[model samples]
Target: MKEESQTIRTKLAKIRFFSPEGFFVCAAIITVIFVAMEALGLRSSVAVLAGASPGAGAPATLGMACLYLLGYLAFVVLAPIFVMGSIFLLLVNLITGIFRRQQRHF
Candidate 1:
């Protein structure tokens, strides 16, 4: 159990923002955040973005809507890009590694 837990910790520690795995993790986090907010009924707050009064207070609702909009937009736009980026980076790394091994054999 201890060894397994330590290995999990080490794997988590290996993820950095600039790495492919880290990008996937970041995308996952962003998607989870968006899902949580949606589950909490924050999606209605987005009505403020369309000039509709979904709640009593315009300013407060608008602010919340704006914040939610930013997060939603980030998830919609950035998450897919991050996933693609991770795949692209993984492929590039694999190709380079293969070439390096071939060169060493020659």
Candidate 2:
């Protein structure tokens, strides 16, 4: 029981959502979805946001278009920013730790 609990804790600790790798993976997945939506011509449907409602034939198209737009903004515009921010934070932490250790020795 003790060993299993320790393993679970380690696994949980390894799950870092704000890490650079995690951000990149999330960005890549969102990009793929955005590209797929664009390939299917959902871009035109998204223009409904400008000043038009989806027609009676497909009410769901409006919802899908909105979702695609949100995904595009999130993945394309925000993901890289998050990735860079995480990297910067990690580097700062590393440098600070090194400085602290050096100070401790001096």
Best by lDDT: 1
Q: Report the CA-based lDDT of candidate 1 relative to the real structure.
A: 0.88
Kindly report which residue stretches of model 2 are placed more than 4 angstroms away from their true locations once superposed: 1-13, 50-57
In order, the Cα lDDT scores of the candidates are 0.88, 0.74
lDDT of 1 by residue, 3-98 (tens): 999999899888888878988998998999999989888888877666676474578897878789988998999999999999999999899999
Count of residue pairs whose backbone atoms collide, per candidate: 0, 0
Clashing pairs in 2: none
Residue 61's lDDT within candidate 1 is 90
Residues 1-106, model 2: lDDT tens digits: 9999999878756857776556655666677887888888777877566657545236587787778888778877877787777688688879999999999999
Worst 10 residues of 1 by lDDT: 48-57
Candidate 1 regions exceeding 4 Å error are: 1-10, 54-57
True-vs-predicted CA distance for residue 38, candidate 1, Å: 0.9
* Residue 35 displacement in candidate 2 (angstroms): 2.5
